[model samples]
Target: MFVRNILSAIIISVAPVSSVLAAGGDTPPIPSQDWSFSGPFGTYDKAALQRGYKIYREVCASCHSMKRVRFRNLEALGYNEDQIKAIAAEYSVEDGPNEDGDMFERAALPSDAFISPFPNDNAAKAANGGAFPPDLSLMTKARANGSNYVHALMTGYKDKLPHGVELSDGQYWNTYFTGNKIAMAPPLMDESISYEDGTIETLDQYAKDISHFLTWAADPYMEERKRTGFKVILFLLIFAGVMYGVKRRIWSNIH
Candidate 1:
């Protein structure tokens, strides 16, 4: 009778705790995406990278900065020296003192790092309602799911909020964001930007493109690294086969 009463008490105590735990873990799982640069053999699609650059320049650049990336880095995306020079020249960069001790702004050079959108962090936060827009240079590498998370985040904004959830002012609902509320508004929409390459301008395409580009931004040497690794593996295999043949010939008379 004592054991039965204790068991009943334990069950009663744990049931509500389990229920609360289940209710607290209600955020939806992020869906995995098929990225061109996912696996060991994967390589970035050049056209997609270019499109992604366009999207970043036209839309995302206003809020985000690619501080670690420079204009010359665009060469990896197939931009020639002249093209890169022209593109860099389009933006003004801060330069120092021509014979004097004052700083001035000048046309950006290919060697220059990307110019930030805001003057400083505090200014950025003030402009965006106290949320500091993070630099995109290493954003993909910084996040857990990297490209998948970015793609999901861009596409996760929903028009309808789920039942029982209330959003505070200045907060928007995003299915993939923690707590389903984010400070960022829906960034992409259908037909938001016209692509010069005639690729269909859809939210998914933009998300995928930017994700791919950000992946490249995060690790620009990925293709070269993969190529080098493949070569090393091939060489090792050949070396092993040659050694095995040599061993067999040397041991043939003995065995």
Candidate 2:
């Protein structure tokens, strides 16, 4: 009976103090981030990313710009000269000489940077309501969760929220997005890409693939890094084994 009264009194005292201390209300949780395929500041799958490249080319190229990526960068992602040439030819670049024996706005070649859909900052901001659609060449690196954020944003879009999170009037849920609310409407759906191979188009798979591909585009040397890391681990294991054997042999003499 005495313990119960003490506990009740403690609870009553703590409740009021807790309420007063938390006058600003609770903070929202940081969005959970997925790092299933990340590596350092620059990493991911080459082949999957290559496929993602194809998706970007066939779909995303219409609105977004990968201004840092050149047509030749596709070759690093696994394309041949003919493919690169064909892709490069699809876009026209402007170039001309000036009075100072220099050139500007020269016609784009395979080596040129991917062109922004809007010509300049003023035009881009004017069109996008002050939100310059960012050059995606390294967006994965710039943002947290890197590519998964993109995947989530692309896949995110439903009429509801899972729970706890209150949806704003225009809010949409993305499975991969941090906080599950995103601005871009779902960009991919199953069969969004028409592959002659008849690969079943599932929205989930496309989002995953394209996100992975962008990861690759942002960093094409992932395979090389993985192979090198494997070699390093092997070398360390072998070195550790040899040192252990030497220690045992030295102890045997002392014993």
Best by TM-score: 1
Global lDDT of each model?
0.88, 0.68
TM-score of model number 1: 0.89
The positional error of residue 236 in candidate 1, measured at the CA in angstroms, is 1.0
Could you list the CA RMSD of all candidates, in the order they appear? 3.2, 6.0
Whole-model lDDT, model 1: 0.88
TM-score of 2: 0.67
List of clashing residue pairs for candidate 1: none
Write model 2 residue lDDT over 1-255, tens digit each, in one string. 999999999999899768743542222322433544554434454456666777887777655788878788777766799888887887787765678866665445788888668777678667644545667778778887666667656655666644455656544565555445554556677777865545457876677777777776676667678878889999999999999999999899784
After superposition, candidate 1 runs with Cα above 4 Å error: 1-26
Tens-place lDDT digits, model 1, residues 151-236: 99999888786666677777888877776678888878889988998898999999999999999999999988999999999999
